[model samples]
Structures are given as C-alpha cells and as structure tokens.
Target: MEDEVLLTLMIEDLLAAEGFDTISAAHETEAMAHAAAAADRIAVAVVNLHLGRDVAGQRVIRALRQHVPNLPVVVITGFDSEAPQADLRGLGGPTVRLHKPGGYDELVPAVLNVMKQVRTGAWPEEGRRKTDYNV
Candidate 1:
C-alpha cells in the first residue's frame, strides 16, 4: 500500500483496469485493517517502501504477513540503493522488488508473475481454504 494519495489512486486504478480488485491503504493501521478484513480474498499486496511521515513500509508488510502468511508482496521503492534490501529479504515468503520512478511499469508484471507462482503452487499454501473475517 502507498501513502501518497495520488499515487495510491493511480495504482489502484491501473490494477482495476487489469481486472483485479485492489484495497488501498495510506498507512500502517489502514493497511493492517484492510488486510485482516480481506485476508482470504487478497491474493497479493503492492507496497511502497517509503510511506511519508516516517511510516516505514516494512511495518505494513509485516502486519499484512501476520494475517496472510503466504501472501506475495511487490515492494516499490524510490530509494533502491538506500533501502534495506536485506531486511526486506529477511521478511521472507514470495517477494519481488522494483525500483521506483520507473518502477510503476514493472508493478503489474511483477504482480502477475507472483500470481503465476501462486497458481502454479510455487508458493505453497497460498490458495488453500481460508475463513473470511472482518476486523
């Protein structure tokens, strides 16, 4: 999830056009709430690594993962060189990292690839039955 309102809307619209329903969150709380609420329906999360106002994207990723352990994450960061790539890698599960500014072009493809992995059972337990719950 992205914190920038305009960017978040743009990404949501793009994904919607691609026939995927998206849940956008501006910060950690909202992201966690949405993820917990729609844990079963959500297939993946595209998160911005730097959410303005000192909210680190890793927090969002960790919170989301708590609900959907096998969820695939596509991390978009403008601070590619400075970002904590090791920390992200440490988060584990299926992940794809894309550098920002031009990374928008890769977002869709990265999501598609992750989904492909889920569908092919490369990401085990991803499609297993899950109960739907509201937060």
Candidate 2:
C-alpha cells in the first residue's frame, strides 16, 4: 500500500485498468487490517517503503507474512539508497524492490512476473529463506 493519496489512486487506477482488483491502505494499521481480513484472496502486494512518521513498509510486509507466508511483495521506495535492503533479505518470500517516481514503469511488470512465479511454483524457494528481485 502507498501512503500518498494521489500515488495510491494512480496505482489503483493502473492496476484496475490492467484488470486486477486492488485494496489500498494508507498506513501500516490499515494495511495489516486489510491483509488479515483478505489473506486468502490477496494475490500479491505492492507496498511503499515509507508510510510517514516511523511506519515502514517492511513492517506491513512482515505483518502480512505472519498470515500469508508466501505472499508476493513489490516494494516501491523513493529512498532507494537509504532503504534497509540488508534487512529485507530475510523476508522469506518472493520480493521485488523498485525505486519510486521512475519505478512506476516497472511496477505492473514486476507484479505480473511475481505472480507468474507464484503460479508456477517457483516462488518461496524450496529450502531457501527468500527470493529477491530488482534489488
């Protein structure tokens, strides 16, 4: 989920146009609530790294994983260099990292790719902790 209303709207519209239904959350709490409630229906998650104040996207990802262990995640961030890439390595599922602003170009493709992997049983690698993409 994205914190910025406009960006979230843009993403929602984009995904909707691509024929995918979307659920949006402006912060971690809303994200967690949505994820928990729809854990069985969610196919993948597109998250922003910063959610204002001290709320990080990684927190949302981790929280969702507690309910859906194999959830695929597309992490979009404006602070590419400042993001905690090292910490994300332990996320234990399929994850795609992208820089914001320009990263929009790759968002849809990334989501589709992750979904493909998930459907093909290529995600959540066997005997492996995690799978990282575009990091």
Which candidate gets the maximum lDDT versus the true structure?
2
lDDT of 2 at 104: 89
Q: Every model's Cα RMSD, please?
A: 7.1, 4.1
- Tell me how candidate 2 scores on lDDT: 0.79
Error of 1 at 98 (Å): 1.1
Mind sharing the TM-score for model 1? 0.81
Worst 10 residues of 1 by lDDT: 126-135
lDDT of 1 by residue, 11-105 (tens): 99889989999888887777778877988888899988777675467777777788887678888887754445424644555777788778888
Which pairs clash in the backbone of model 2?
Answer: none
Whole-model lDDT, candidate 1?
Answer: 0.75
Show the lowest summed lDDT stretch of 10 residues, model 2. Answer: 126-135
What lDDT does each candidate get?
0.75, 0.79
Error of 2 at 83 (Å): 3.9
In TM-score terms, which candidate is top? 2
